[model samples]
Target: MSRFHLGLIINPLAGLGGPAGFKGSDGVAQQALALGIEPKAAARTRTALECLLPIKQGLHFLTFPGPMGADLLAEMGFAHQVLGQVHEGPSSAADTREAVEALQQAGVALILFAGGDGTARDICSAVREGQPVLGIPAGVKIQSGVYAINPRAAGELTRRLIEGGLVRLASGEVRDIDEAALREGKVTARWYGELTVPEEGGYLQQVKQGGVESEELVLADLAAWLESNWESDVRYVFGPGSTLHGLAENLGLQTTLLGVDVIENGEVIAHDVSEAQLFELVDGHPARLLVTAIGGQGHIIGRGNQQISPRVLRAIGLGNLRVVATKRKLATLEGRPLLVDSGDVQLDDAFPDVVRVWAGYKEELLYPVGK
Candidate 1:
């Protein structure tokens, strides 16, 4: 197989600028030191880089000169040629743009970056269209398809792609949530577009989950069908997303915008249910877990909604799990397969082969997961 020149960049501050409540890591270095938290972002970055060490030399790699990308690469014991240099107190969007330019000049076959939507946007401008790229989840809010499900997944995908294995290729959604509104208990996501990526199959990036993250319902007919078929005996474990809430909204019941809630029949049985409570509710009554994709992250679980772990998914059964999203939302999933990271690797591997997404009417789309 021909060796590919892989570019690496890290917008260390993209998601750090998010709300204080979200634990944005831009100031985490300071916070950790103050609280004597021992390790900091540097430690976490090293941990993430360790995942990539196994296959670093197998593929030709290019990166910024210093902390922009190389510093961490160096900490990982990467002894190789460096591309550009920009070591300062912190990394920013300007540095991201410069690094992209440098990598573009170097003619990298792919640019695997680590950041959120802002970083994705910078890379988008660099590509102008599509470039073979991937993301290592590092930022606070990762609402972009560029990121792999997690750091370890990023390294594994790199290994598979570098080996020239037959892999699935598709465009992933580049969705970003406005950080400001998220602090106000409102989730406002804007669909940027799509990106071509190598699908390492089982790896799932965080995506805007559920049938609805958007407030407006374009799928009125499908919503009506779900409403008509609504079962009273069933407890609906509504995952985080605006789309699932639409099912509740259609019935004139209030749904929590950012938290998970439980619904039975046509009434809101539980609101803002905790993970333990969720398990209890599921145990007592049969429940169907419904969720949407992260706008950019493409994650089905273990991102913000840690409530639905392998135990939860198992209790509900994969057959009973309902993933709902609009055609536009599904369009965001074009290049990437439906991702399921249930925290437990064994169970995550046993995830449903095909996710039944309610695209429209009786018309549904079957998305292959771990394909």
Candidate 2:
């Protein structure tokens, strides 16, 4: 197989991960170390480097400046060239924007970066088309298509992709949350654009979305499917969305419509739990996450339900998660892998072979979500 040329961007402040109560990882860099949060961008970068470590010499890397991209690669002992201006370290999100331009100018096969919703937004703004890309979880709230589940999985997939393994990259919509509104328990997601998603072995992680659905029948079907599937040992964590609220209505439980709800064996255990709380609940039981796409724009995680934190996803097992969507809603996916933008690097990496979305009774569409 021929060597692959990849472009890397590191958004230092993109998601920070502070809002989820998991501590921030990319806040100005300096404060992160002091607080022991560890720079998330660096961690994400390291994940990529470590995965590429054994094959470093065979790979060509183009990256942003220190603290932005290059330095992390250097620290990981990889040989790579710096792209554009070496600004010591990217001081702000603007640096990421600048890196996007440089990567496009250099002409790369794929553009890889790490960050959450804000970082995805920055990436979307930088490049609208050209260059397939993926992400390594590094931000606070990841909600985009440019990222992989985790760093190691990214490396594994990179190997397969470069080695001529049957692989394809698809476009997934870019979704973001209203940060100000988020603080007030209001969740909002808007379409930023689309990015390339790599598909390996017909597996794709669940993608989160945000939009308005006027039809009531689709909601009704989604609710019916969820109700039929509830069983013992299946702890359901309902994410915020009208579709999810519909499920809650079927169960005769009050749902916040925009908050995380926990359903265990037909009982409402908790309502609107936080990331920590969600994980705590997950610790004791087997979980099967139930969430819906944002609508128009498709996303499964990292949009509004920050409460279902990365830790929670990890505890629940990515394979155990269920993305419930009506046929009308699934139509919006357009044969793309569902997006899972969880900010935790490990959880992002832990996603399963085929994310079994509740398509219909005994009928599942095997989508390619990851490499």
Candidate 3:
């Protein structure tokens, strides 16, 4: 009969560094702003909160002041109590910890934060073992497994939590890497502490697995087939990851290992192109998107390669899309469907059935793709 109390926190600068080409959004907010990059945490948080609006009557919100949290809830017509103050400048890690401590002291049932792994680490540092915390992924390079597959999924999980339908609260991984080294093309992710999260089968994300042994032979065979069938005049957009990087290497082309690249006539045309550049490139030319799913996560879009925006996907057309992954990588998914979060809900709903994935030379597997 009592009301459900949910604590909320938002790191306004969580995703500002992503599109600005910074490896992570940690201490690079000012630099990203100087480069004309706007913060996305607020918008992303709104998307999640909007999904929870249907059940607003039964829930009472506890959140931080201003843009840090309460503003979005208030704007959405939800009842909430504001916690500690955040000064006019950027919100620091200390502010997040203070908010968490205050929310815990207020006896909230759960805490929902909008940020990246850094924000997750802050929650882990502040909350006790049984304190429930969930993440609404609003950052670049989401190497951790604590986040939902997308903002909508996060909202769905929260809805179940508030309705008392969420029966499982499992410990999910909290991982992060050195942004400085990651920017230098060196990927070294370290495991941090775990946090209690609401879990729903096939809806929540699984922990991201570490690098697997290279599937060189299968990748080489796939590359050989690609080279032979590649259209002479068509442009191919290669998404990030080692799989696509291997394909680039097979063609003797240099690619930004962790950034999107464009190949045409067996040459690198646009190296590390942005979303706008991708839109321009695919305007008139026959283009195809060659992307691979993230291991364990099974996300073909919206993980690290945000440059391949939904607009870019529409330009290439779904028929022009080609997915490539090793058999070993597919095995890690363990029957979970491949996922997508292109930031367009309509676009995400367009493909609800299975899509063919190129697993090897003349090899194909029909994997389910969903939002």
lDDT of 1 by residue, 61-106 (tens): 6787665667776667665458666746656566777887877666
Quick one: ranking by lDDT, best first?
3, 2, 1
Residue 269 of model 1 has an lDDT of 85
Clashes of each: 32, 23, 0
**TM-score of each model, in listed order:** 0.47, 0.50, 0.54
lDDT of model number 3: 0.81
Top TM-score prediction, candidate number: 3
Report lDDT per candidate. 0.65, 0.66, 0.81
What ranges in model 3 sit over 4 Å off?
201-371
Candidate 3 lDDT trough over 10 residues, lowest sum = 201-210
Better candidate number, 1 or 3, judged by lDDT: 3
lDDT of 3 by residue, 1-371 (tens): 23457889999889888898887888898899899898899899899888888878867899999888888888999989998788768789999999999998886766889999888888888888757778999988787888988988898877754442312546788999888888888988889888877667332132124344357877788889888888898999999999999988887788988999999988899999999998999987799999999999889989999999988998888767878887668667765667888889888766524455776676654455545
Q: Which ten-residue region of model 1 has the weakest summed lDDT?
A: 202-211
Estimate the overall C-alpha local distance difference test score of candidate 1: 0.65
For candidate 2, write residues 269-335 as lDDT tens digits: 8988888888888886878888777665667777887787777776787657777666456556554
